[model samples]
Structures are given as C-alpha cells and as structure tokens.
Target: MTTAATDLRADAEATLQRLAGSGAQLREDQWRAVEALVAHGRRALVVQRTGWGKSAVYFVATALLRARGKGPTVIVSPLLALMRNQIEAAERAGIRAVTVNSANTDDWQAVYGEVRAGEVDVLLVSPERLNNPEFRDQVLPELSRTAGLLVVDEAHCISDWGHDFRPDYRRLRTLISELPEGVPVLATTATANDRVTTDVADQLGVSGQGDGALVVRGELDRESLHLNVLSLARGADRFAWLAQHLDELPGSGIVYTLTVSAADELAAFLRERGHAVTAYTGKTDPADRERAEDDLLANRVKALVATSALGMGFDKPDLGFVVHLGAPQSPVAYYQQIGRAGRGVERAEVLLLPGPEDKDIWAYFASLAFPGEPQVRVALSVLGDAGRPLSTAALEPRVELSRGRLEMMLKVLDTDGAVKRVKGGWEATGEPWEYDGKRYLGLAKARRAEQQAMLDYITTDGCRMEFLRRQLDDPGAAPCGRCDNCTGKHYDPSVGEDVRVQAQEVLDRPGVPLAPRKQWPSGMDALEVPLKGKIKPEEAAEEGRAIGRLTDVGWGPRLRPLMRSDDLAPDAIVDAAVEVLKGWGWTERPTGIVWLPSRTRPALVESFAQRIAAIGRLPLLGALADDAPPRYSDPEDDSEPEPPNSAQRLAEVYGRLSVPVDLDPSSGPVLLVDDVSDSGWTLTVAAMLLRRAGAPAVLPLTVATTN
Candidate 1:
C-alpha cells in the first residue's frame, strides 16, 4: 500500500478505538465510506442498520478532515435526542461538538462564537434551523462556504418519497447547491427503500446531474431484534396484555403509541397498575423530556410510553425491548421505530400489539398530507392579494385549513419557491406553480399500499423480520431464526380474565374535563368580527364535561362512529353521560336543560338532550334556535370548512342562538348540551345567551370533544 494510504488506515484505526473502545475497528464497508469522505472528498450516502455505527464514520471523518485544517463539519440532525447522543459520542472521540436548536436559544450566540473561533470541531443543527430567517440570511451562507463536510442525518427525510418526508429537509437542496465543489457531503439513514434511495441520491446529486453520491448500503437487518406481532380485539385488551406481561420483557425499553393521547393514557394506566413508567410525547416539556430520556437510559424507569416524538434519533445501545400499542401508518415508519431496540444487546424483544383502531389512526394522519390544488390556490390568493407577509395565525382564518396543515403546506410551498417565509410570516413569490396531481396521487397510492403492507405484516404467517426487510427492499431479505413466526411465539397472547376486567373498567370510566375558553383569538375585528379581548366572566360557561375525547383509546372507538351515524347514541353512552352528570359535583343543580342546534346530527343531539332531561328530572327547555342562515352559503361546497377561531366563531354565533321566548327568567341555572365540542365556541356563545336570558349560570355538557 502507498505510504499515505497506510497512514490513513492507521489514523482511522486510532480514531475508531477512541469512538468504540480500545479494541474497536471499522468493518470493510465502514472504512470504505470514511475513506470516500476523508480521502476522496466524495459525497456519500450510507444506508445501514441502526447499530451499524453510522455516526462513527462521520465522527472519524470529522477528526481526520479537521486535522488537515479543513473547516468544522456541520450535521443537520432531525431530533434533539439524536443531537444529544451525537454530541456525547463525538466528545468521546476527542472531538468538540456543539448544538444550536430551539431548546438552547440562549446558547446560540456562544455556540456561534465558538464556531467562528475554530474552537468547535462539529456543529449539529436541527433541519428547521435551515429556514430560520436570521440564520438563513446571516449565518448559512458563511457555513455553506466554510463547512468542511455536511452531514444529513436521517437523510431519508430529504426525499418526498420517504415515509417521513419533512419539507424542511428539502431546503437542504439549496444549501447543497451553495456548497463549494469538493466538500464531502454524507447522508445517512437506517430506513430507506430502493425508491427512496434513488430519489434521495438524485436530490443529493449536483444540480440534477449524473450520480454524485458514493452509495454504501448494507443489509438492513438487526440480528438482535426479535420481532413479533400480537393481534388484540380491542384497545383495552391490548392494554390488559401489556399490564399482564410488561415485567416479563427483557429490560428497560419503550412502549410506542400512534397518538399523544394514547401515550399519556397508556402510561397512566400502566402506572395505575403499579408499573414504573412515564409518558413522553410532543407535549412533554423539553427539560422533562430530557429527564425522562435520562431516566430510561439509567434504568430508573421501566419504560417510556411515547409517541413518534421519541422516535428517529434516540440512541440507547443496550435498550432491552420496544413495544407498540398501535401500528404506525407505514411499515417504513414502523421499521424506523422498532430499529431503536436491540441495538447493543444480544436479543431485544420487539412486539406489536395491533388494535382494531390502528387503521382509523392511520387514516387520520394520512388526511393531513399535502393539500389539494383548490386549497393551495386559496392560500396563494389570500397571500398574494394581501401584499404583505402574513403569519400562519393570521392566514388561518382566511384559509380553509387547520393551522398544522396550513403551516405544513406553506413550508412545502416555500421549498418549491411558490411562497417565501419572511420575518412576519409567508408571502407569495408570484411564481406560477403547477399542482403535481400525478405525483400527489402516486404518494397517496404509495401510502395506501404501505398501510395494506402493515396489515399483511400483522396477519402474515411468514418470518416477521423477513417481511420488514422486504419492505425496505433489502437485498439480503430472508427469514431470521429469531422472530415469533420463525420460532414459536415467545410472548403470551392471552391476558387473565381479571386483568381484562380491570382494563375494561379503566377504559370505560369516562368524563374528560372541558376547560372553558378564557381569551379570544387576536385580530377578530379585522375579520369584521365584533369580539375582542378576554371573555367576560359572567358571559363565559363554567368548566364542563365531555364523555370522552375522540382521540381517547377507551371511548374513542365507541364515540367516533356516533359522529357520522344519524342513529341515537347507544344505551351505554347515555348511561355514561348520566354518570358524568351524577359525579359532576356542581354547587347548584341545574333547573333546566337546553340543547344547541346541530347542523349535521340534529336527530342524535335532540335525542340525547331529551333522554338526559327525562332521566335527571329537570325541566326540558326547548333547543336554542339558529336565527342566521347556514354558516356556509355555498351549497355546492362539499369540503369541510375549517372552524373559525374563538373570536370569529363567537361573532358568527352572537345573534344566532335564541333562547325560548316563553321560558321563565328565574330558571336558576341551566345545562347546555351539544353532540360534540370542537372549538368550544358553539358552547361558549350558547352559554352567554342562556346567562343573559336570566339563568344564573350555564354548564356545558357534550358527548364527545375534538381535541
């Protein structure tokens, strides 16, 4: 070998020792990737399994490149947990790494100073940072010019074809274009099918030229992962099994849920059953999330019941197991999450406790994908006519989309150069953008196919590991001797009857407190709404109750079907509603009950109100009359209208709800009933009318709440 080649090998060996241990060495493929980046200065994409030491390649390369007086490496990471792990791992290799993310806003200036002084060897940034106005305008250009290496972690997100396509990661194309020639770029992910791989490689290529990335892909299989799927009839049954068998799992690990509500609910149930577990979700406070992660890492907690917020980048080498309470929408996403387990252990158990409601959850998330052409046109028209950048909040009322969906659309549009996000918000760029109907339809088809594949995964009597590897198009797809189907089922499928009864009791216990809206949304008058500021205490409804949240695993399945059905609520729901009223602990019993006008399910709402009044022995006051025309005038508009914010909703309902003209003014207090409470504005306005019509107080009750 040449002297330089021999020296490079020796240096790489020393760095590997520092990264892994004294006896650690890079495998042939890993060395090839490191050499491609450090010696050949070629862009590379590494599609390896979770525990294959993808981080080591970049860290070692960073060390070698920095030694040659090249600028510091910048890693665009997807999650804070991953960033934390990478920073620590980099430190162990004698590399100084600093992170700038939303959590460490106060430290950004200091981190920038360190980066400028050449005191930092590596800098980790969240992908969202790439679009920040200040960072993009001021810092990004310099980083693009000076960065010795650019690493995109969780790189599959860069491709729209990937299961977790993040629009912010698409901004990397602009950054990549700005980079000087010969600067090595590395994109690494554990999950990417052949299509996603090709798409990502094309995106990583220089200006759509010939293949620019040196692809290093290995078999996407974890030998330590013992995969299994347990089909349960109901969500409660799944919880029962978890309660029965949680302790028998290998070690401390994660219990994944498809929704934030499920994570919190499952964690609460497990804790009630005497398990040492904590809930981790998107709503978890950053500090608390850090503590929870630490606790799990230190084996202080038995498991962290979490949503996908805890997925992607969390690294725990010896994590003992991973359990899913519900199936994720796509097998690719499922593979990414389960990959978290069995990373550093001989055999980490991975189980999927699939529920009947899994498909419903999947469908709900799928509905949030890119908007239709009509919706996109509406957004652009609103922005273009305004002539000023409008924040998402301001734009929400004018557009017929939810705030989350609206923002996501805006980000995608911004990446496509149709809209530009500025200091205030987003403005139209006047660029004529064509709606890619074919591409979107293809994506929708792909998603459905993925959902079906997950269903097949549940029922397939074939090797579970082989099924997942095949989903990723892994060339080495074969039956692993470890999965449940390959070997006999290692986990008990049945829960004790006593445990099932307890789980049913916990889930069936209903009544979620409905907090009253305290303040109105800002800028109501500009929309020609006659409301502003905090809601008057006398006009507001008292804290209320709903039978359950539509997202709750317990009542969700039961209540959701009622949403579209014209049939009266079943006997069980009526009994639950009565239970809610009995346990309400009100200071004064309501003298009368009134119902809100329901445009969609009038029959269901009226029946529920009559039943409640008859059972409670309260005076049955008539339903509140809607004096105004239907909320939307266009009869042909089949699209579901986005409910206006608090102020707009209040304005629309202000003069519309009329109390019974013959009702006695001395009716003490009244119970206001609605089929569902979605912005809580309908109940709010109705309560204000009741209070003004001489009731001393108004108490709102609904069968379900849309949170």
Candidate 2:
C-alpha cells in the first residue's frame, strides 16, 4: 500500500481499538465506508444490522477529517439517549463531542461558542433542534457552509415509508440542499427495508447523480440472539409469566411494552415481586430517565420496563435479554427493538409474549397519522384568519385535535410549506398544498399489511431470524440454527397458578386519583366562552377517585370494552367501585348521591350508582335533569363537533342540570357519579350547581378516567 493509505489504515485501527478494546478491528465494509467519506469525500449509506459498529465508522471518519484541517462534523441524531451515548463514545476516541437538545438548554450557548471557535470536533443535535428559531436562522447557515462532514444517524426516519418516520427528519432535506459541494455526508440505519433504503438514498442525493452514494449493506444476522415467541391469552397472564420467569433470564436487560401505562404497571408489579426494575417511558422525567439508563448500563437493575422511548441508540453492550410484553405493529419496529439484546454477549434470550390486544393498540396509534385535507384546511384557515403566529397551546383551544396530534399535524404542515413555525408559534404561509389522499390511503393499507405481517411472524414455524431478515428484504436471508423454531421450543410456556393469582390481585386493585384541572386553556374568550384564568376555588371539584384509568394495562381492557358497549355494569367493577369508596378518605361523609345524566350508557351509570348507594346506606337522590338539549354530539357521527376546550365544554354544560330547587342545605356533601370522566368539565360544572343549591361540597366518583 502507498504510504498515506497505509498510515490511514493504522490510524483507523488505533481508533477502533480505543472505541472498543485493544483487539478491536474494523470489518472490510466498515473500512470501505470510512475510506469513501474521508479519502474521496463521497456520500455513503451504511445499512447493516445492529451491533455492527455504525458509530465507529462516523467517529473514526470525524477524527481523520478533523486532522486534515476540515471543520467540525455535524450529526443529526433523533433521541437524547443516543446523543449522550454518542458523546461518550466520541470522547473515548479522543474526539470532543457536545450535544444541543431539550434536556440541556443551559449548555447551548457554551456549546455554540465552542463550535464557532473551532474547538469542537463533533456537534450532535436532535432533529427537532434543526427548526428552532434562533438555531435555524443564525447558527445553521454557518454550520452548513463550514461543516467538514455530515452524518444522519438513525437515518431511516428520513423516509415516510420507514417504520419510525419523523417530520423533523424530513426537515433535513432543507439542510442537505444548503451544504457546500465536496462535503462528505453519511447516513446510517439498521432497521430500514429495501424500499426505505432506496428512499433514504435518493434523499441523500445518491441516485440520478454523478457518483451516487456507495451503499454498504452486509448480512443482517445476529448469532448471539436466541429468538422465541410465547402466546399468552391475557395481559394478566403475561404479567404473571414475567414475574415467574424474569429472574431466570441471564442478566440485566430491557422489557419492552407497547404503551406507557403498560410499562409503568409492569415495572410496579416486578418491583412488588422483589425485583429491581424501573419504568422508562416518554412520561418519565428527564433526570430520572438518565439515572435509569445509567442504572441499567451499570447492571444495577434486572431490567428497564420501557416503551418505544427506549428503542434507538441505547448502548448497553452486554445486555443479557430483551422481552416484549406485547408485539409491535410492524416487523421492522420489532426487529429494531429486539436488536437491543445480545450486542456483546452470546446466547442472550429474546422472547415475544404476544397478546390479543396488540392489533387494537396498533390501530389506535395509526389513527394519529398525518391529518386529512379537511383538518389541515381548518388549521390553516384558523391561522390565516388570526393573522398572527399562534403557539401550539393557544391553537389547541381553537382546534379539535388533542395536543400531541395537533403538534404532529403542525410539524407536517410546517414541513410541507403550508405553515411556518416562527418565534411565537406557527403562521399560515399562504402556500398552496395538496393532501395526497391516495398516498395516505396507501400508507394506511401498508400499515394494516404490516400489522398482519407481525401476526404472521408470530405464527411462523420457520427460523425466526430468517423471518425478520426476509421482512427487511435482506438478500442474505437464510435459516439460522439459533432460533427456537429452528431448534425446538426452548422456553417454558407455563406459569404456576400461585403466580397467576398474585398477578390477578395486582391487576384487580383499584383507585387512580383524578386530579382536577386548575388553570383554564388559553384564548378561550375569543371563542365566545367567558371562562378564563384559574378556576374559582368554590366552583372547582375536589380531587376525586376513579376505579382506574382507561389506559391502565391492568384495568384498560376491562374498562375500554365497557365504554364502547351498553353492557350491564360488571359485578367485579361494581365491587371495585365499592372498594374505592371504602378506601377513599373523605373529610365529610356524603349524605346523598347524585348521578350525572349520561347521553350514552345511562344504564351502566345508574346501575353503578345504585350499587354504591345501597352499600354506603346514603340516600339516593334522583338523577340530574337535563334542561338543555344534548350538548355533546354522537361519537359515531362523521360530522361530530370538534372536542371543546375546558371553557367551551363548561359553557355547553352550564345550567343544563337542575338540582331540586328546595333541596335541604342541612344535607352534607353529595357524591356525583359518572360512567367516565374525560375533560373533568362535566364534574366541575356539576359541582358548581350542587354547591349553589346549598350542598356543602361535591366529590366526583367515576368508573374510569381517560387521562
């Protein structure tokens, strides 16, 4: 080899050793990726399996390019956990890396200063940061003009066809168009299928151009993983199985759940059974999440019960196992999650405990996709008429979408050029946009197909590894001798009856407190609703109790079906409601009970209230009389009214219920009963009317809450 080429090889080896260990060496394809970027300054896409050392390729390239007097490398990462892990890995190679994300706002100024001063070797940023007002307008332009190398980690998100598409990742196209010529760019992901790979490559300017990106794809196989699937009939059975078999797993690992409520519930149950585990979800506090990650990495805990928030870029090399409590909707997502295990250790167990409710969860998430033309037009019209930028919080009261769905829709609009996110919030751009109904319908169909594929995967009798490889369209798909199906079933499918009984007890336990909404939604006055500011103390309902949340993994299955059907109140639910009442420590005993009028499921609410009244021996007051017409529209109607904010909801229900005009004030507090509490506005307004009728107070009691 030439002197310079030989020297580059030696440097790459030394860097890999620093990153991994003394004996670490790059595979042939990894070296080829590094050479393409550092020597030829060409864009490259590396599609390999997890644990293939994608980060090492970028870190090594960054060092080589910086040594050649190039400017700092900029990486657009997707998650904070990934960024933290990358920064530490970079430091191990003697490369300085800093991150700018929501978790570390105070450090942005200093990080930017370091970048501008040419003292930083690598700068890591979240995809969302690319659209920040100050960062986009001021810092991004300079970074684009001067970056030595650009890296898009978890790059599958750039394509809508990918399993985990993010609109923020789509914003990278703008940044890509601005980069100067001759700057090497690299995109890497382990989860993309053939379609996603091609889409991402074209977006990286790798197709229909001179010297398209060199695509480096290797065999997508992990010899260390022993895959298996166990079908459990119910959620409680899965919990019981985990409690029984978790200790038998090899070492510290992660337990994946499809929903946040499931993660919290499973973690609590595991802890009660004397296991050291913590819940990690989007709802977890930032500091607490970091601590949990650290604990798992250090082997201080048996496992982290987590949702998809723990999916990408978490670096625990020797993690012993990965257990899925429920199946993800797509095989691509499932493969990515299971990839977390057996990265460093051999024979790490990977199991899927499939449940019947998996498809329902998948459908619920699919409903939050990009809004249709009608909804988009409504949002743009609201912004155009306002003639001012509206923050998401302010826009929420004016729109019908939930806060999460609304933010997602706005981001998609912002990317499509129909709206511009400004300093304050968002403004209409007046740009014509077309809602691709065909494309959306196709995407919906694709999602259903994927769900079915996941189901097919569960029932497949062939090699599990080969099944996943074929789903990714990996050309190297072949049977692996490691899977449970390829061999025989290696995992036990049975749990003891005692464990099942214990799990049932935990799931049946009731009482989730319902916190009252204290402050009102913003800008309600413009909507012709008079309510604003903090709720009056006397008008507010006291903190109340519900049998459970509708989303709780324990009670959700039971409560959700009840909400949809007009079935009679289940005896178990009635008993649970009594237990809640017995345990509820009210300062004053309720002298009477009042039932909230239900437009739907009146029988269920009345039956439940009667059961409580008979058990507590309180006088059963008559149901509240509805004087006004039905304020809420039928949920099954396509033209149903948008969900109203607190003010609008209160306005609709105000003066609708009539308490007895001459009800005795000598009666103590009254218990207001409802089938469900969504916004808590009905209870708030109902409490105000009861208090005005001279009752001392009103305490809300419900079968389920939607929060």
In the range 1-707, model 2's lDDT, one tens digit per residue, is: 67988889889889888887899999999999998899889999999999999999999999999989999999999999999999999999999999999988999999999999999999999889998989999999999999999999999998878999988887888888899988989999999998899889887775425675788988899999999999888777899999999999999999999888789889999999999999999999989999999999999999999999998999898999999998999999999999999998877999999887777678668867877677678889999998889998778767767677788889888888899889999999999988888978988898888999999999999999999999999999999998899998668778999888989888889998888768766777666666778877876778889998877767988887887766678899989998998899989888998888877788888988898888889888867777888655423222553555454566567646677655543388898899888878788877777777777888899999877
Pairs in steric clash, model 1: none
Instruction: For candidate 1, report its TM-score.
Output: 0.96
Worst 10 residues of 1 by lDDT: 633-642
Candidate 2 Cα outliers beyond 4 Å, as residue runs: 1-3, 208-211, 625-666
TM-score of each: 0.96, 0.96
lDDT of each: 0.87, 0.87
lDDT of 2: 0.87
TM-score of 2: 0.96
Candidate 1 residue spans exceeding 4 A from truth: 206-212, 632-660, 663-666
